[model samples]
Target: MNTNEEHEPRIEVTAPLGERYDEMLSAGALGFLADLHDRFASRRHDLLAERMRRRVEIANGRDPQFMPETAWIRQDLTWRVAGAAPGLEDRRVEITGPTDRKMSINALNSGARVWLADQEDATSPTWANVVEGQLSLHDAICGILSFTSAEGKEYRVTAERTPTIVMRPRGWHLAEKHLHFVDRQGRSLPASGSLVDFGLYFWHNAQRLVDAGRGPYFYLPKIESHEEARLWNDVFVFAQQRIGMPRGTVRATVLIETLPAAFQMEEILYQLREHCAGLNAGRWDYLFSIIKTYRSRGSEYVLPDRTQLTMTTPFMRAYTELLVATCHRRGAYAIGGMSAFIPNRRDPEVTERAFAKVTDDKRREAGDGFDGTWVAHPDLIPIAQAEFDAVLGERPNQLERTRDDMHVTASDLLAFKGAGGEVTLAGVRDDIAVTLRYVESWLRGVGAAAIDNLMEDAATAEIARSQLWQWIENETVTAEGERIDVELVHRLRDEVLGQLPRTASDRFDDAVKVLEQVALRPEYPAFLTVMAYTRYLGETPTTESTTQPETPAQPKSAREHARLVGERDELPIAV
Candidate 1:
């Protein structure tokens, strides 16, 4: 070698991974990984692909899972109850009376599937007493799990969230071996952007549930985007790989409240196709946000009646429509959001009016296409379920109605009304799809058996392209202005100064009766009041870390079904 005198030039190498690059890496070609492979053994190399295999499951903004089931059979709720189990931890409000505390062991025993004991930011009690109460809760859950149906058959019962008790690995193993993996956790989990990896706590815990014999159910909170849902899927995949829960044993319900999420509804629905139980209305934050959303515009839209402001507005309509479509498209249950803070006892008049309102909501929601709705109070259970029962039995047939509505076609015609069939740049329209979405929602409650115009399979969103052969058709729905407007006649009738003979159900007859109840000026003084109450729950807030989820670790189909059947048998409970 000629050294410096007559030397060959030496080349310097730098890695693309910057300072973190390894000397073992040989090439500068890789963005990062390539260089490592050159120095490392080929045996360690593998492609990083998505865990679910590269099958893209969504199509034209819909999940394949949301289709109507061809086979029809009614499912009974036996070992379960379907209403909110009041916050055992809800210190802001108390359910205690001379006869009962807001939530009771009897209610837990009354076939509720989820008894959400209060754990976060509620109550007033000593940590020790709360811990003791949790121990009691654990015992109660154990008892419930051991409970049998009226037929005296043991339905491998699984209890939920007794107290946030930590399980020694062995106790966890034993409990899981006995009952289902439990639904033992609840919290706001208030992360701003997204939730932690579903796999972070998901896989380890799900394996525990799978081992213990329970299906997995989780309530994911603080969700703000569709990517949050993807994260859930990723977690599920990892959990499945570790614990062997089937692709869908685990289920989750996202609380819909954050404003950004309202527009991302489709993506959120698609992202959690297999796992979603549907969305719920988180009222407190939503109303608070409404104030913020309208602060700049002022409160011109504010309603005098709070009830009138129910999630039943235009935005609610759009949000629910997308939700129903997404759920129906994916063959999942499209649940209606909450009607919260209603008084919980069953007063006949209150129940009747509540029933009517709920029916109307269910009907309207059904018209918009929702499968179920939430009733916040224990007392509202009967009314809510009865309303839903009317619709559940008819889904298979009404699904056909949805298909037919999809057939209404469109074509170019005069943008404005004119002589018949004059072709213009204006496009014809049929809102049957929009209307049928509402009809389908009503059908989901009753389990009715009827079939009409139900074969809804179609290949295109363009109404004309779908049935292009119809190349020419034009129609407009009857606008309200087109309806009859009859005025009182000054002319004498056939009988001379007489009106049509009245029947008991006649409109004029009913109006006359209503007029008798009020003076002509009609001032009985009916005005709604908005009030706030600072109620105290009898428990103190302790760091939730002291409490841990007590879910079953194993999942068994038979037991789960039996448990659900028992759940269905009980009247829906309210708190």
Candidate 2:
């Protein structure tokens, strides 16, 4: 808790951030200035301890390992919306699934990347596949890292080679992923808590690559909190010690999706900011929380439609801003979120339009700006990379922008506007600092957060704190005094007023119709964009959530795998 004697945030400072400052400096000298600006962080006399603590955390968050700058939204990694259909039409969908040959090839093709193989969510398959009753996560991940499509030209793209398999965060618990039902015998489940295989998993994986003289990396999944992040750090430390793969070499990219974790973004980032290679905006899980956390009280929060709500919403903008800020602040590459679907079959318009929309979003994000965006479909991958390349468009990678905002001064910090756009510069920059840290933590793919933070009940307090303030301060909004149902009102304003813009290039009424069916229904509540996220997962990823999730299915046999690849469907790539 941070407070003054009267419980207000202290506003005075003891010393400046630098050793000495009697001279003037230019904006070009700001990078060196941030280094010097940091010394003053310890002089928080007027600030609350909590705020100052966070400030210090931000100050000390200068590390080569942190990945606040890059963007990688995990849910978009797959094209399927929980195995329903391709959200859009596209060429070559890459189906990233487990050993289960039961997965639909047709569905897998929904996106370009068929990221077959599982480590985090597919633990059931990992454990079940243990021959002699012993399965290793390393082996399991290795087993399905890459896939050969229906066309025989086996795409060599994969996170193979344990050293190449980076795990920024290694401590992962299954229950954190909401695989609710545990063993009937009621034994401690793997998901419920960090399991033993975790350390061994990384150690074995890292060792595999070290012996082969390569770097190891991973895509950490389902992270819910910071302790989980620290736990992962611990695992990496252990793996580094045991595997002899250079003590600080264990690397990973994490996913940010669940509810509580999203709010605690800064704290999570502070905990593991240095270890991230990239950050992801776990779109689907985040949307699931938006409604699931809210409407479970017998009511629902209906967002506008996907096309209308996703790319253009205030929250999404804020999220993208944070991602961009994190990347810039940390000197890491900023990535963008996914566009949800990929074209399953070739229809130039479907893919062309989808790619165009994705390109637009990515371009906008890059403009605002981001480093890269994701595509679940292989075709989309090239498109995403192309968009990024185009935006970066021949600009030589200027080492000039590297970490210039470090030693932030009173003046520099004072210039930021915060989410309200009304904050003093310092506050805005501080907020950017915090948000960036969290985004970096999210990008350490393959790691998992804890179970507690992945809440079923939503916390509206943050909405009250962040959104309400943001709404009130916005220069564009014109509403009467604090409306009774603030959340309801703001939501309605967007719903009623923010009808899709034509430039959105999506069917407004149809998108609304698609969302409303799930929203207005008495079946279940609708929050952020869970339906959209689930739609994305089912469409690209092999698995779909059902009333009852059953066993891990078998994989394609050698002959079947060969056959699936031998016959190339000379179909068009997109609509």
What lDDT, from 0 to 1, does candidate 1 have? 0.30
Q: In lDDT terms, how accurate is model 2?
A: 0.34
Kindly list the per-residue Cα lDDT of model 2 for residues 1-575, writing each as its tens digit.
22222221111111232221211112222222222112221221112122223322332332112223422322122211110011111112122322223222222333332232333332221222211111222433345423355775453323321112222221232111111112222222112212322333343455555454434544555565555565556555545654355555644445666544554444454455545444456565555444333322111122322223454455555554554454444433444555555554546666566667667765665556554454444456666656556656655222224343433222221221221222232232222222222212212221111111211111121121222223222311322323223344335434432532344433333333322323222222122112322222211322224411122233243222212221111111111
Error of 2 at 55 (Å): 26
Per-residue lDDT for 384-479 in model 1, tens only? 555555665543212222221321111111001111222121111211221122122211211111112111111011121111101111111122
Best by TM-score: 2
List runs of model 2 lying over 4 Å from the truth. Answer: 1-201, 211-213, 296-301, 393-575
Off by over 4 Å in 1: 1-107, 110-214, 238-248, 281-285, 297-305, 341-353, 394-575
lDDT of each: 0.30, 0.34
| Clash count list over all predictions | 92, 117
